[model samples]
Target: MNFYKDLEPIRRPIKDVLAEQKLFTNFPDNWHVVVADIVNSTQAVKTGKHDDVNLIAAGSLIAAINAAKPFNTEIAYFFGGDGGTVIVPDEIVNKILSGLNAHKINSLKNFSLELRVGSITIGEIIKAGHELKVAKVEIGKGYNKSVVIGNGLKYAENIIKDNYLQDKESIEHQLLTIDSSELNLEGLECRWDRIKPLTSSLEVVCLLIEAVNFKNQSTVYRDVMIKLDEIYGEADKRHPITMNRLQLLTTFLKFKKEMMVRYSKWKIGHFLKAFFETLIGRLYFKYNWKVNDLKGQEYLEQVIAFSDTLTIDGRINTIVSGTKENRLRLLEYLNQQEQKGLLIFGHFVSTESIMTCYIENRNDKHIHFLDGSNGGYTEAAKELKPKLQML
Candidate 1:
């Protein structure tokens, strides 16, 4: 059953969403928390492989979501720039895992990136003395984001990391050859050039924050969000993507690189087809023309509204465009919180944000992923590591 789909969307502000525990629903015991991470992602990003690392991470979510589509299932998933986590029902777990396993193999073979895959049962999480609660918030006209509270997910991640480090996980994973029909990353796209802010003086910040105590997570997040708004304006004002300035970057090399994982193989012929399609896409957006009854202007608006700007899964992860002065103001509040033992945060600043997208449909079924160019969340988390050690 699509439990997530049935949950009522929280219509109030996020602060209200956090305070209303009554609105939070229990995660079904039959479902699971599946996670996959790229090993040594920091080192990989350091070598100018941020796009590669992010591509594989996005693929992890794509493969899993695409697999579920056949079964008419909707899953709640998170993209971490390095890896991702997904919540899925029991019936489709095996098939989703098959796609993820294939993704793992493809990752290693194609990019020399080692991907670690694992899963933890929701029932097992409940038994371990932690709670897993989920809430849905509408981000746009037809898209909703999953907000997970409590320490259960953090507990599962810890277990998964430990097991992976010890080489204790026994996973049966296979590769997707050209002849196989199991894995599909057809919706994944990276044609956009690095997105610059509309404001010439603004900077893109990739931020991550974690609460010290599980019990205070929701409230702490509420406060952080409120403070961010006071300093940076609303989410739309601070969103890193600017449609007016958005540009496309497509080359034969990019096409080849993406296809290596997208189709499990690349061909010069496919690039030619894509090259012509990009030409048409450019015309559509440039002239605001209607294609198949979908206007480019409307699609771009949806893109702005549906971009994954914030993700809360026992932590706060977001990308925003703001001035250096305003960023300092936001950081000031976060630093005070760190001193007061409420939360600790990490952030990286860059001239523009990197965008990777998954477009199942241009009309209404697409999501864009953003990160600061160079190294975004990965670098921010690196800055957060020593602070974590102090904890």
Candidate 2:
């Protein structure tokens, strides 16, 4: 019953975790990988709606999370800038898909963006000779993130995407046709304003890295983490979010945007209630009120503590803040690795960071997602994909 939940958290340095294959176990055959992405995200980002793109991607995880809650399994997921990937067992796949379809419909009606959702079983990927090595890594302050090594995710992405391309019209029809109104995004909050670095000298960089040879992935990624630890210091030294920079967005416009996600058809009464909640929230955070035994200051610490600043899903994707000098050194090291044909990387720079949060349980269970305000990982990918072509 504890398929996903009971895995012991690995507290070793992430570098060591990646190198120890025995630490990552194979996923069960009955499980499936669920993937979702906004179609035409490149053009969408150009229009300055990267925030919307980010939310839709987060939606997939939230919807699936809500669906899986009853089954009592902690599904592991990755939130890419434009979309996300989640893995769930077969017992709840239908309910999960239904919820995702509902979210897709909401996305089209509100943002005019097409969200494609699909799933492929682990059995099939294993049949095709790919591996799905997974583990839960404890980052700090009792929070954990799911890390994956091996080509399993890459193989699933390729197949799901190819299928979408071949059956484009079917996807469109399902979006309009699937009528599932049971999407409970209860604690999905995006109220924070864009977070600026603690100082003007620091800039946010969204970076992506992958090994060239499949077999070298373990060693290559291990080296990247070791290098990052050297350049960035511990995670706290270069964190983008700090207590002083945490401010709730109390604008009516912000409420209206969130309303579209919680309600399919808007209700003014509900909107007013939410607007008042934001007003009250502003004071709660400002005053550091101990409402319901949860401290605002302490919660801010956990927000930084639980933030998805670094993620490894057969590749390394991270957003961090640092001086230009530190960034240059990182690039220099990465370039040297690339020249050796050990790895390839892509990165984009921006002025500040933005956050979208999922806080189902205020005290114990929650995590925050961050992106560079401009484009984050998607913008970084523009550089990364071109490099892939020459290979």
Best-performing candidate as measured by TM-score = 2
TM-score of each model, in listed order: 0.95, 0.96
Residue 220's lDDT in candidate 2:
90
lDDT of 2 by residue, 22-120 (tens): 898878898999998888887898998988888778877888889889887888898888888988888888888888888888888888988888899
| Tens-place lDDT digits, model 1, residues 123-207 | 9999989988999888777788899998888788888888777763344322323224566888888888788899799899999
Q: How many Å off is the CA of 23 in candidate 1?
A: 1.2
Residue clash pairs of candidate 1 = none
**RMSD (Å) per prediction:** 2.0, 1.5
Q: Which ten residues in a row have the lowest lDDT in candidate 1?
A: 170-179
Which ranges of candidate 1 are over 4 A from the true structure?
Answer: 168-180
